[model samples]
Target: MSQPLTGVKVLDFSTLLPGPLCSLLLAEAGAEVVKIERPRRGDEMRSYEPRLGEDSANFVLLNRGKRSIAIDLKAPDALERLMPLIREADVLIEQFRPAVMDRLGLGYAALSAANPRLVYCSITGFGQHGPRAQEAAHDLNYVAASGTLSLTAGSDGAPVLPPALIADIAGGTYPGLVNILLALRQRDQTGRGAHLDVAMADNLFTFQYWGLGNGALGQWPGTGTDLVTGGTPRYQIYRTADGAFLAAAPLEDKFWQRFTELVGLDAAALDAMPPPQATEAVRAAIARQTAAHWEQRFAGQDVCTCRVVGLEEARRDPHFGARGLFSRTVATATGERMAALPVPIDAAFRATDATLPSPALGADNPLLDH
Candidate 1:
């Protein structure tokens, strides 16, 4: 099957996570992505720890199936060098702060003037015109500013650090991909492109919609007090006797009853107890057994409870293997290979032979000469 973005051309000027991830998704969907990097020193992510040949494992993982073109955008004739490619490009995604691209003469207005159908996307920590637009931030800061971090408090009421880069991938990357696709569709109708201002901080509010809705009606519970956050015994992580954890989320009454019964707890007693007391009782019951014991106990159960496996175990799990989630491998410049990072795009949209090694600096510059 042909990929949805089979013939689209993208010029990616993003670094690190958000914009690179967005372009990576597009590349997986069969877009021909040309990543524009600075001369000599490329994306900083290339220097991250756990090296794979010339670049870091992270760089190789995110940049597979894409071309690299090195150019110093700060140079006087950089815009002239990029004009030819921009004119032929379908999308241009950048992650610099507001006005940085404009100062370099490659902002949306300038690029769109040359290519009227170009989809120019800017992924930033905040929107271009926001009060915090120019403020430096990373994934954690963006989530903190968005009020989403406050909801991730631990039992002691301190905000827990997120296990993943939620703001970067969910807020910036996913939203940018969605809007860019939407802009492409819109361009097909109007014969004009658009400037997408993807604000990581702004997009995070969607994740808190339930909390926001509840808070609006003066039903605001304190941190870690919501049904999904730890207020109830039905949904939480419990430590086992072996110090490993099991995530229990039997939210529905029937599933909760099943879980309670399996743990040898009286369902009626838990029901009559207050939430804190019920939570304590559930915790005590789970602590009595090792994680392996609970894992075996819940193996074929309908209850929504499971042991928390580490990343290495998850990577080797039969379920993921059966689904072919890690079937793809990415090669480094030196021909070393590692498992390709997973993207959520359907397998149908990915070419079976799509894997390509991360490019050396200026490896594809000849394409720009034309």
Candidate 2:
């Protein structure tokens, strides 16, 4: 079966999480994504240790379903080789610091002149024109700048970095891809490309809708009291007796009522308690039972809750497995089987049962004439 993005070519000059992830999505959707990396060393992420082999799991995961072209961007011959490829590309994505592309002569003004219909996207920690645009930063810095760090961790506990780079993935990668696709659609009608500047920090504020709303309305409470950030009893995690954990988010009254009933809460106990006290009581009750006990008790209930799962447990989850959430495919470089990326379009499009892999370094540069 033919894919929707077949024949579309993407030149990926992004590295690390955000840029590569965006292009990976394009590749999964059937676009031919050529990842342009620095010569010799390649992507810095590939050297991340703690994995079992030469290939870093992070690099393998993000770079799947795309081709790699290792080149020295500073070299004169490199730009000449890339210019021809740029002329035929539908999209060009980069995550360098502001004006780095312009310095290399591959900036939007330079490249779009060669291909008017090309969608040029630049992802950065801060926006292109911001006061901090030239500052060197990473995911932690971006989240901190966006004010997202204040809403993280518990009140008494030290502010902690999230397990995921929410700013990079949600703000930078996903938004970049979405805008690039929108630009492509607009170009289809107008025959003109667009230059998109996606800032990782800007989207952080947008992701914190509840917090932002409160700040705007002058009703946003202090750090630990916010509704969605573990403030209320209805949406929090509780530790169990066996050292495991269970997550409950019964936001609606019906679900909360069901939760209280399942836990056998008395009317007097419920009436006399504040939200925090109620949460503490619930936590104490949960701590009395083992995780397995709660899992059995909640089996048939319609409560909006479940156990807190780690990466390994999530991989084996029946619900996700049934839906083909972590489908496997073979890598073209080493023929190694690995989990395919999870990106659902609609019911008509099956995200699983399709085999595609990341390209070996510079594998597709020879196919330039095609």
Candidate 3:
């Protein structure tokens, strides 16, 4: 229960993936998060498919360690009732469309006036400013704008939508968490809070650092041809027999040599194979064997290769188990154990217990009344 953010209070006015996840990370680190929802339905994510009893797994996973308060933001006295909580909050997060907060008279300018040291974070698809600032968008749209989606599809195929919401969580949620903590640190030094504009599109661009940074400097031509982005034969995925996969990430010469040797590929073959050709060649080599055979063939080798595993297989992987990746806790509602946080703060870092049961809606009574 002890952590760096133990005494901090966070006001969460966000819903779904990005905003809720940001606050959940803070709460997991021991901050007190109060999620403000609509009076009637609360967050729409509560009803997402694949329910764990009455609550969705998506909702329970993202909303753990936070308290929820259902409030009518449009009411005449809504702002008045929220002002007291705002005054005590160290951080305020919202992910509504660009003018939504201002329309409700609860914009950053208004709330920050009540608490000068409040770290006001706004998460959006585009940003607070720009030609497309007010336009509505989803994860795919944001990643497309940032050039991430185009480079992430199968070779010579149309871009495929990824299963994960990278734009929302990696772009919006992570940046929001980092900036909120930074704003809090700045407040400690200067006694002032700063406004944070976290756009999923902008964050996606930042996330593609190896691509954007090198491409802009003319070191890389951009697109999937870059070394790390499917440009190199040494760092791509190849299909095995039965359509299973083997991942090759041997960037160094030594590792690549070992990988080629194991696959019975001549060293000269690597020089002749671009990513596309190499991928096909590797696929052919792998297709000669089953996944289990390749796994055994590649084991104890320093070629940076492994079998591509699905979620269930990954959860039960020996390496993940050895590293203590997936700790378990029983959910209060379902009593079914689920994976807990994966971040391990070492002894040198602050170690807070993140094993508490997830909050039922408005579980913290005192925070709701204020």
Candidate 4:
């Protein structure tokens, strides 16, 4: 029971972030993942800057623990060659736009005929048969189209660009993995596979549940409007005297009382005041002290107030190390190593390999012959 997917075989036909990250999770859980890449250049991510040895750091991190098989799908013999692998693959993941796979003769209907039990997963920005299905899009575009960007306002009265790729990872990768696992489970009972169309834009509505409900009630929630959207002093960011930002979210009355008291504010007066005026008071109080001063005051306090640190400081946090978040490692072809990209999968499901190497172009091509 150490690794549940010990005998599962995954044929990864996607690249870049979402699809590769999804396959990485399966590979970590002992799935034999064979990454199908184009010949010569392989995944375009391999050429991205910030190289980690011969491959881009992104490619190395995302494709870790997977074997590579290079093939030119445009070749006349391509479908003939892929037939063997398709017949044996338990899962096939692709992120090409609608009908692109069908043109290449590798569509779900085509491949599922070869292996009736294949769980075919297709991740795209829209879907297989929508007006915007063929439109090219990135994470930002998806978020914008899904009404998420409208709520993320910045100080300049414009939407703030998210630091993380919410649409790619949360919208696409997670949903892709969940559906693939569910399809596999269903196959175990019915002995038939399914075609999963995971649309990143469509999946985004799930994260906007609160806003949707409020909108349905005609309140129309947005940045600086909803409670969680900084409508109240209780859930807002403040600038400290030392130029550090404190993300404070003491939404409950008890936490808000504690927070106001810690910052030397009259809790009753602030509560009686309008939200805008109350926010101004809290901001003024926080601006009177350095981040270090408040960090010390709020150290063990349950007021939900803390100084925000840069990415480097957050990465070096002792809490993550104590939890063995970076215990696993990824190695380069020349044997250099770095901490592997931490995945959300539980450690119990990971195989006992301390380090795994990302594949070189066509490293597992011989498997194509067998």
Candidate 5:
């Protein structure tokens, strides 16, 4: 069966995380993604550690199934060379700072003239024409600037770094992908295109919708002091006797009651407002047994409890194996095969290619010909 995006073409002029990730999803959905990279050096992610062939494993994983074309935008003929692809492309993703594309004559205005149906997306730390539009930042900076980082904390009451790139993936890549698809749908109806400005920092606020409403009510949650952020006995992590952690989130009253019963705690302990003592009691009870013991005890219960396993353990679990997530593979330069990075797209929209490889630099540069 043909995929939904089987005929869509994407010109990816972005490097590193957000834009490349977005284009990767498009490619997985059967879009023809042609990555435009800097000449000679290619994407900087190729320099990242733990080499796979000549490029980093990170680069190989993120760029699998996409073709590459190396070109120096500063060169006089660069625009001319890219014009064909730009006109043919249905979607274009770029992450340069504001006005940088204009300097190279590749801004939305210039490209839209050549292809009126182009859905051009710009991913940045701050949006175009903002006070901090040109300010250099990464995932951490975007989270900090958005106030979402303040919600991350431990018992020490100090803010903890997030385990993932919250801003890059959740904010930029996801929003860019969603808006690009929406713009394409709108074009189908209106016979026009859109220039989307996706700012990672601005988009991070959507993750804090609850916090925003709380602030509107003059009840803003502080660091580590909210229902979902480790403040309540109903939703907190407790250490087992074996030193592993059990993440429990029985937020509803029924589940909380079941959790308290299973943990051998007095249900009234949590009924007291601002449950510091109740939380400590819950912690003490959990610490009395190993994670395995609690796993058995909590099994088949309404209490949402599970042991926190390491990445390797999680990957090797039977559940994920049964789901066929790792059935698709990408090969290293040496032909060593591993699971492909799991994409969020439904498998029905992706080809059943058993294995794919990342393209060599400029491997598809011959596309320039008429």
Candidate 6:
């Protein structure tokens, strides 16, 4: 089947996670992506630990199926060298702070003038015009400022760092991908492109929609006090006898009733007791049994409870294998295989062949000489 973005050309000027991952999705969907990196050092991610051949594992995972062109945008004739690629590209994405591209004379105004139908997207920590637009931040800071971090607290009631880069992938990459596709659709009709300003911090509030709605109504349940944040007995992690954990989230009444029964809880007594006492009772019961015991008991059940597996276990899970989540692999320069980073794009739109490895730094520089 023909891919959705088979003819689209993307010029990716972003680095690290957000921009690279977004362009990876575009490439998986059959867009031709050319990643522009610094002349020698390339993306900083190439130097991240756990190297795979010539680049880091992270760089290989995020940058598969893209061509590379190295250029010093600060060079006097940089614009002259980039003009051909710009004219041919349907999309351009950058992750610099506000006005950086403008200062380089490669801003949307200049690019769009050269190619009126180019979709120019800028992904930044904050919106282009915000008070904190130029402030430095990473995934942690963005989630912290958006109040998402406060919702995830440790047992001692202090906010904990999240295991995932929610703000980077959910806030920046997904929004950038969605908006770029939307701009392409708009261009199909109007024959004109748009400048997309995707602010990572601004997009994070959507992840806390439930809490935000409650806050707006003046029913804010303080940090870590909400239903899904360990406030109730029915929806929280419980320690097993083996010291492993089970994530129990039987929120609906039917599932909750089944879970309480399975754990030997007297539902009537639990209802009459204080919530904290009920929670403690459930925890105590869960701690009496091994995680393996609960894993077996909950098999084929719709209780929304399961053993908390480690990253390696998750990678080897039968369910994920059945879904073909880790079926794709990319070859390193030395021919060693590594799992391709998974994206949410559907199989119908994804390329079927093994993806190309991340390019060597400036491997496609000869194209610029033309």
After superposition, the stretches of candidate 4 with alpha carbons farther than 4 Å from their true spots are none
lDDT of each: 0.91, 0.81, 0.80, 0.92, 0.90, 0.91
Q: Please give the ranking of all candidate structures by TM-score, highest first, separated by commas.
A: 4, 1, 6, 5, 2, 3
Q: How well is each residue in 1-370 modelled by candidate 1, as lDDT tens digits?
A: 7889999999999999999999999999999999999888888899998999999999999999889999999888888988999999999999999999999999998888999999999999988986889999999999999888888888688999999999999999999999999999999999999999999999999998888899899887567578988888998999999999999999998898889989999888998999999999999999999998998888788889988889999999999999988888898778999889988999888887846677776789998789
lDDT of 3 at 262: 92
Model 3, residue 297: displacement in angstroms?
A: 1.4
| lDDT of candidate 4 at residue 156, scale 0 to 100 | 72
Q: How many collisions per candidate?
A: 0, 1, 0, 0, 0, 0
Which pairs clash in the backbone of model 6? none
CA lDDT for candidate 5:
0.90
TM-scores for all candidates: the values are: 0.98, 0.93, 0.91, 0.98, 0.97, 0.98
Better of 1 and 2 by lDDT: 1
Residue 205 C-alpha lDDT in model 1: 92
Comparing candidate 2 with candidate 6, which one achieves the higher TM-score? 6
How well is each residue in 96-208 modelled by candidate 5, as lDDT tens digits? 99999999999999999999999999999999877899999999999999888878866686778889999999999999999999999999999889999999999999999
TM-score of 1: 0.98
Worst 10 residues of 3 by lDDT: 343-352
- Residue-level lDDT of model 6, residues 60-122, one tens digit each, is 999888999999999999999999999999999999999999999999999999999999999
Which residue segments of model 6 deviate by more than 4 Å? none
What ranking of all candidate models by lDDT puts the best one first?
4, 1, 6, 5, 2, 3
> Which model is ahead, 4 or 6, in terms of TM-score?
4
Candidate 2 lDDT over 1-370, as tens digits, reads 7667778899999888999989888877778888888776788877776442456667877887788888899997777888888999999999989899999999999898999999999999888996899999899998888878877767576678789888899999889988988998999899999999999998888777877777789887566576777778888889999999899987887888888788777534764688788788888888998989999998889888899989988889898999867665636476765776676454343334467666666666675444
Worst 10 residues of 2 by lDDT: 344-353
Report how far off residue 209 is in candidate 6 (Å). Answer: 1.0
